[model samples]
Target: MPTKQEILDLHFMDARYKLIDLAAFLDRVDRHSGEGDFRFDALKAALPLLLSEQQGRAKAVLDALSDPSIEPIEKATTQGASGAPRPAGVPL
Candidate 1:
C-alpha cells in the first residue's frame, strides 16, 4: 500500500475540490425556499460518514443515500429516480 503522504500527494487536490463543490451545493440549497426535500435529507444523512474513522466510508455513504426498500412499486410516480429514496412518513 502507498504511504499516507503518498496517497495525499496523489489525490488531496481532487478531494479538496469535491469537498468544496459539495459545500457550494449545500449553500445553494440553503438559499432556496421551499418545503423540505427528501433527497436533501439523504445527502445530509450521508455527510457524517465523511468524518467517520471507519473503513468503507464510500460504501457507507452510498448506502446512506440508497433506496432501502426491497419491494418494487406497482406504478411509476414520476419519470425517473430522484437519485435517493425519500425518508418514510415524509411528504414529497
Candidate 2:
C-alpha cells in the first residue's frame, strides 16, 4: 500500500499535469479563434479564479494535515431506516 505522502505526491503531480493540459488546450483555442471570441475570453477570465480556488483548497488540506492539534476525521455514522447506527463514508 502506498503511504500517505506518496498518495499526496501523486495527487500533486496529477494536478500539475491537469493544469498544464488545460493551458495547452486553451492556447490552441486562442490561436485558432478570433481575438474577441466569447469562449476564449470567458475561459481566460475564469482560469485564474479556478486556479486560485484550487490552490486555496489544497493549502487548507495541507494545513489541516500538518496541524497536530487538528483531529482526524472520525468514521462517519448514520441512523439507518431500522434505527441502527451504520458506518458511512462521505464522498469528496
Candidate 3:
C-alpha cells in the first residue's frame, strides 16, 4: 500500500505528465502558427494544477519510501553462494 506521501508523489508525477503534454502541444502550436490562441489558453488553465502538484510532490515521495510494502532488490552475483571465483572472461 502506498503511504500518504507516496500517494501525493504519484499524483504529482501524473500531473507533471499532463504539464509536459501541454507544453509539447504548445510548442507544436507555436511552430505551426503565431496565432495559436487555443493552445495558449489551454496551457494557462493547466498551470495552476501543475504548480500545485509540483509543490507537494517531494513530500509525497518521502511518504511512499517510508511504506513497508515496498521492497528493495539486490543484484545477483556471478559467483555461487560459497563466493567461489568465476572463470575469466565471464560477463556479469
What's the lDDT for all of these models?
Answer: 0.86, 0.52, 0.51
* Candidate structures ordered by TM-score, highest first: 1, 2, 3
lDDT of 3 by residue, 27-89 (tens): 777688456343245335445553464677545444433323334327655443222222335
lDDT of 3: 0.51
Which is better, 1 or 2, measured by lDDT?
1
Worst 10 residues of 3 by lDDT: 79-88
lDDT score, candidate 1, position 83: 78
The positional error of residue 71 in candidate 2, measured at the CA in angstroms, is 44
**How much RMSD separates candidate 2 from the native structure?**
15.2
State every prediction's TM-score relative to the real structure: 0.87, 0.40, 0.35
Residue pairs in clash, model 1: none
**Candidate 1: Cα lDDT at 24:** 99
User: Runs in model 2 with CA error above 4 Å?
Assistant: 1-7, 33-36, 51-92
Question: Residue pairs in steric clash, candidate 3?
Answer: 5-60, 6-64
Expressed as tens digits, the lDDT of each residue in 1-92 for candidate 1 is 99999999999999999999999999998998996578888888889999999999999988888888898878765787777877678543
Which residue pairs show backbone clashes in model 2?
A: none
